[model samples]
Target: MIDTIIFDLGAVLIDWNPHYMYRTLFTDEQEMKDFLATVCTPDWNEEQDAGRPLREGTDILVAQYPQHEAYIRAFYDRWEEMLGEPFHDTVELFRRLKISGKYKIYALTNWSAETFPVALARYDFLSWFDGIVVSGVEKMRKPAPEFYQILLDRYHVDPQNALFIDDNYRNIVAAEKAGIKSIHFTSAGQLEKELEGLKLL
Candidate 1:
């Protein structure tokens, strides 16, 4: 039987996008897109999530893109602005799951260590997780079998009886390899349907 539920934080439970902060900085949408695509790209951001210091990451980008120094720095300077709001529907579903007393709820997220504390302080629902594994804190990230194993071993969770939810297909595939069932989350409504179908909701 499924006795554990794991949720990915960004995009699944929280709405976070660089556009939320970048749009106000650049008048030309294309310019912002180019900066995000070429400079502070997802891969670069993932480095921070993997435990590289934020300052170091920002400095490297600033040195490489001297012309866009301010923009590069602003990526983290106003990082909290990138956070939109919690997905209320998803949060409600999570709340229901939590109070159901039927499964252990946990979170696994690829977020910077420096900024994660801000999220912890801002969102009360975050405290509801029985446990959380943060990439930055752990210095490891998803799609890597070892990282998922850490969570499984640490929690003594049976991969066969646990379900993982994430917005990233790559992570979903990795979860399957770890022997954990997973949902490639797209929307809260779809998530609810899947859970209900599994007799979880």
Candidate 2:
């Protein structure tokens, strides 16, 4: 029986999208997309998620792409703008699960440690989790099995009894390899159905 639910914070619970912030920075949609694709790629952002300081990451990129210095600096300087309001449906589910007092709730997210404080301060619901494993603080990011293992080991959680939910397919595959069952999150409505099928809701 699944006694624990591990949540991926970014897409599953919070509305975090770099596009949201960049849209306002660039008047041309194509230009904004190209800038994100070429300059501040997901791979580059992942480094910060893997414990590289935002300043260091931005500095490295700024040095390499000196022409795009302002854009690079905006990444860290206005990081909070990348985040949006919480997904109320998901938050509702989370609160309901917590109220049940039957399952253990935990969070595992690939968020930059430097910018995480802003989220912590902004969202009161974040404190609801029994524990939260942040990749930036741990120096590892998911789809890394070691990242999942850290949560399992630290919490004394049995992978077989845990259900991991993430928006990324790669992370879900890694979780399954680590012995935890996982769901690829699409929407709160879908998640609600999955939990119902599992008899968790």
Candidate 3:
């Protein structure tokens, strides 16, 4: 039986997309795509998500690609603009789970500690979680077993009794390997069915 629901913040609950912010920065869509692919790629952003200071990460890129310095700085300078409104379907599920008061609710996300404050300030529902394990705070990102262990050890949550929900296949695989049951999130409606099957909803 599942006693806890562990959630991933970004795609699962919050609607976050870098393209929304970048589209406004560049007049040409192709140029924006090129910048995202070559300059500010997901891999580059992951380094910051792994606990590297945003300033250091952005500065390095600014120095390396002097021509794109302004663009590089805009990544963090206009960081808040990248975030979208919460997914209402998921938020409703989260609220229902919280209101049920039968299970512990937690979150595990690969978000930078530096920028998390903004999220905290913006999202009132974030306080609903009993706990949240942030990769940037732990200096370890997912697909790494130690990160899952840290959550288990800290919360004393038995992996077998907890359900981890994430959009990333690799992270879901890692969570399963750590002995936790996981759901590869596609949409909130799909998640509802999964939870219903588990008798959690």
Candidate 4:
């Protein structure tokens, strides 16, 4: 039986669009794409999600792309806007799961400390979780075995009894390797089906 349900925040509960922020500053589509590619380079957001300070990451980006210094700053300046809105149906699903009292709900997200609180303020649904393990705050990120182990230890949950959901395939694979059953989240409908398949609902 699945005793716990771990959820990914962005792309799962909320609508996050990197293009929204880039579009605000860069009118040219190709230029905006390139800028996004540069800013979200593996080393950049990865480090930030893994607990690197926001200012430090921003400084690195600024140093790398001096031509867009102001724009780079604006990226973090308008960070909240990138989180478009909560998906009401998904929020409702979480609420239902919580109220069912069938499983312990938790949030495991790869988020920067600076951005997490801002998102929490806008989306009250986040408070529903029994535990929230944020990468930046925990200094560990998805796809890392240590991070999942941290959740396991903190919650005192058995890997076989846990179900982790994420939009990223690699994260799901990692969780599976750690002995936690996982689902690559695509949509609320798909998630519902997966839960049903496991007889969680």
lDDT of 1 by residue, 88-136 (tens): 9999999999999999998989988889999999899999999999999
lDDT (Cα atoms) of all candidates against the true structure: 0.95, 0.94, 0.93, 0.86
> Which one is best on TM-score?
1
Off by over 4 Å in 2: none
Model 3 lDDT, residue 12, Cα: 90
Question: Candidate 2 at 44: error in angstroms?
Answer: 0.4
User: Per-residue alpha-carbon lDDT of model 3 for 56-104, expressed as tens digits?
Assistant: 9999999889999999999999999999999999999999999999889
lDDT of 2: 0.94
RMSD per prediction, one decimal? 0.7, 0.8, 0.8, 1.3
Lowest-sum lDDT 10-residue window in model 4: 37-46
Regions more than 4 Å wrong, model 3: none
User: How large an RMSD does model 1 have?
Assistant: 0.7
Show model 4 residue runs off by greater than 4 Å: none
lDDT of 1 at 76: 96
